[model samples]
Structure formats: structure tokens, C-alpha cells
Target: MEAYFIGLSFVLAAILYPLFIRMLKIKNIGQYIREEGPDLHNYKTGTPTAGGILFILISVLFGVILKVPLVFLLSLSLFGLIGFMDDVASIYKKDALGLKAWQKFLLQIIFAFGLVSLESTKPIFGVEVSRTLYNIFWIFVIVGASNAVNLTDGLDGLAGWVFITAILPFGFLKQDIFAIIVAAAVLSFLLYNTRPASIFMGDTGSLALGAFLATFAMHYNAEDALVFTSTIFIVETLSVIIQVSSFKLFNKRLFKMSPIHHHFELLGWKEEKIVGIFAGINLLIALTFIVYKMW
Candidate 1:
């Protein structure tokens, strides 16, 4: 039964992307290449974007059909909604800048807080913790994971690969059909999202994937494993933080660009090479976690 649903999600995503891309093209809605990004990316301008909407829809629809808990679906949709709004704002403005950082953060926190508030205020990792601190920690996990995946989406097929690997262990360890379905759907998305992409997932896809990861961790008591599974995202986010801090405090630039993948791009690394290496690393991390758990 799970296999049937997972296969259905894959086919659905495969079908939805081209249709969505055509609709976006007809509506004259497309991606706006960032001014500060790699010059090589200029050709990607006007490519159909916000392709993440299709997978998010599939996940939610399947979640409903499967009778998966509402909280998980809510988390996915809320974050996807945030990403959708950001994508729309970026397209409307004709620039890569979408919602302000603070605006997005505020929205993420509000929704994350609401989600965690409903969770039991039990001791974390068997350590007694205050309710305030406990809620704050989970909120941080959700918000942080959302932004981390968003940061990692710089390269073609990068986030999609990492998201699949990162989420698969959760599916396997927890016997979660929903996680499997999400991963299968994302795998389908990668068919069109690879180098010389036909459509970009934009913030909508990346943000929702991150939120789903965090919520999945919370749902399965796998928060510790998530830190390992999401190493690629963490590193990508850290690269941006380090670059900004170094330039601001020491007046020295650390990398050619932030988000580490762009740094590799500036080093003349091919998009395929960068995605391959990063996804390989993410796969290793996820496999290691799986081994440790099964052992």
C-alpha cells in the first residue's frame, strides 16, 4: 500500500512540474536571477520557478488521503505558504529579494511556536527543562532548519538531493510512509531541477522541505539524528554566516560568495560537480545515521 502511494506521488510530481512550468510561462511568471549571484546564472533568468508548489500539494493531498496526523501537514503547508508568498513577492518585484529577512523570520517563528506549543512539554533527552526553554529549542529547530535548506538551494539539484537523503532515514527508521512519499516526490522533482534546470523550486520548495525535516524529527524523536542528516544544510548556512561576520568585523572577505556552493562556483567548479560532492556528503551522513541506529 505504501509502495503504491509512493509511486503515485512520484508520478504525480513528474506530471505536475511540466504543467506548472507551462502555466507559469503562460502567466509570464518566472525566476529573477540575483544580481550578486554567479554571472553564469544570468541565462537562468525567466526560467519557470516556484516549482516547489507541486510537491507540497502532493504531500498535503497524500497526507490527507493517508490520514497522517494534521500537525505534520499543517507544518508543511504553513512553511510552504511562507515560501509561496516569498516567491510571489520576488517575481512581482522583478528581483531576487522577496520577503525581508525579518518578515520571513517573524512568520516562521509564529508558526513554529504554535506548532511546538501543542507538543507535550516533556523532558528533552531525558533532561528536565523549562517549558519556555523547551518550546524555544523546538522553535529554533524548525526556523533554523527552514532557513538552512533555503540557503542550500543555491545549486541546481542540490537541495532536492539533500532533502531526499535527509528525509529517507526518518522514513526508514520510523516506518513513516509520509516521509517516503515526500522523498519520492522530491526525487521526481529532480528530473527537471537538475543542471540547466527547467524549473526551480524557489523558496517555496526549499522552505517547506526544511520545515518538514524539523517536524519529522520532532514527530519521531530523531532530533539528534537530524543534526547529522542535515549536515549539508548546516554547512551551507554557516558559510553565509561566516562570510558576513568576517567581512563586517574584520573587513576581510572569506569566500568569493556566501553559501559555500557559490564559493565553489566562483572557483570554476561545474554545477554538476558541486551538487555531486554536496549530495554525496549528505548521503554519507544519512547512511551513517542509519547504520548507527540499526546497530
Candidate 2:
């Protein structure tokens, strides 16, 4: 059953992407390149975006059909909606800045709270936490994961590739068919999203993928394992934090740019190379953890 659905979602994503890209182009909905980003990315300006809407739609439909927990679908859709809003804001404003940091953060908090509302106090990493603390921790995970994936989405197909490796562990560890199904859709999206991309996932896809990763872990009591599954995302996020802190406190910049991948871009690494390396690292981490668990 799961295999059938996975194959179906893949074909659905593949078929819908071209039509979606055409509609986005016709409507003039496209990406706005960040002026401060790598010069190589300037060519990507005006490329069709919000391509994530299709996969999110596919995932939600399958999630419903499979009768996965309602909370899972709700969190995924809400976070994806936040991303869609961000993408729209950027398009409307004609700039890369979409929905002020505080606005997006606040919305994530609200929706993250909604996600945790379905659960009471629970053990986190084998340690029980108070109800309030449990709420706060999971909320942090959801919001942080969303932003982490958003930050990682700078390069073509980078986030999508990393997400595939990051989420597949759930399928192996807990037989979570939804994880496998989403992975299939994401793999299909990468066909167009790779280097010299036809469409970008923008914030819409990245945010939702991150949210789904976190919510899936939460559902399975795999929060601790998420650190391993999401190693690349954590490192990417930490690079930004470390860079910012260094600049503020030490009057220095750590990497050529924050998020680390941009640093590699500056180093003359091909976008495809960076994506491949990062995704490889993510896969290695996931497989290592899976082995440990199985043994």
C-alpha cells in the first residue's frame, strides 16, 4: 500500500510541476533574488517559485487518504501556509525580505503551539518535562526546524535533497509511511529543482518540510534521534548563529556568508557539488543512526 502511494505521489508531482511552473510564469509569480547573496544567483531572479505548493498539496491529500493523525496534517498545512504567505509578501514587495522576522516568528509560535496542543506532558529524550516545558520545547523544535530548512534553501535543490535524507529515517525506524510518501514527492520535485532549476520551492516548501520533520519526530517520540537525522540542518543553522555572534562580539566574520553553503559558493564550489556533499553528509548521519537503532 505504501509503495503504491509513494509511486503515485511521485508521478503526481512530476505531472503537476510543469503545469504549475507555467501558471506561475503566466501570473508573473517568481523569486526575488537577495541582493547580498552570491552573484551567481542573480540569474535566478524571476524564476517561477512557490513550486512547493504542489508537493504540499500532494502530501496533504495522501496524508488524509492514509488517515495519519490529524495533528500531522494540520501542522504541515499551517506551516506551509505561513511559507506561502512569506513568498507572496516577497513577490508583492519586490524584495527578498518577506514577512518581517517577528511576524513570521510569531505565526510559527502560534501554529507550533497548535501542534503541541494535541499532546500533554511527555518524556523528552527519556526525561520527563513539565507540561509548560514540554510545550515550550516542542514549539521551539517546530519553529527552529522550519527556519533551519528555510535558511538551507538558498541553493537549487539543496533543501529538498537534505529533507529527503532527514525524513527517511522515520520510515525505517517506525514504519511511518507518510515519511516515505513525502520523500517520494520531494525526490520528484528535485528533478526540476536541481541546478539550472525551472522552479524554486521558495519558503512555501522549505518551511513545511521542516515542520513535517519536527512533527513526525514528535509523534514517534524520536526527538532525540532528530538531532542525528537532521544533522545537516543543525550545522547549517549553527553556522549562521556562530557567524552572527562572531561579527557582533569579535568584529569578525566566520564564513564568507552565513548558512555555510554560501561560504562554499564563495569558495567556487559548484552548486551541484555543494548540494551533493551536504545531502551525502545528511544521508550518512541518518544511516548511522538507523544502524545503531536496529542493532
TM-score of each: 0.97, 0.98
* Predicted candidate 2 versus true structure: per-residue lDDT over 105-180, tens digit per residue: 9999999999999966779999988889999999999999999999999999999999999888767788888889
Q: For model 2, where is the 10-residue window of minimal lDDT?
A: 168-177
Per-residue alpha-carbon lDDT of candidate 1 for residues 45-124, written as tens digits (9 for 90 to 100): 99889999899899899999999977789888999999999999999999999999899999999999987876777666
lDDT of 2: 0.92
**Segments of candidate 2 deviating more than 4 angstroms:** none
Please give the RMSD to the true structure for each candidate, in Å. Answer: 1.1, 0.8
Alpha-carbon error at 142 in model 1, in Å? 0.5
**RMSD versus native structure for model 2:** 0.8
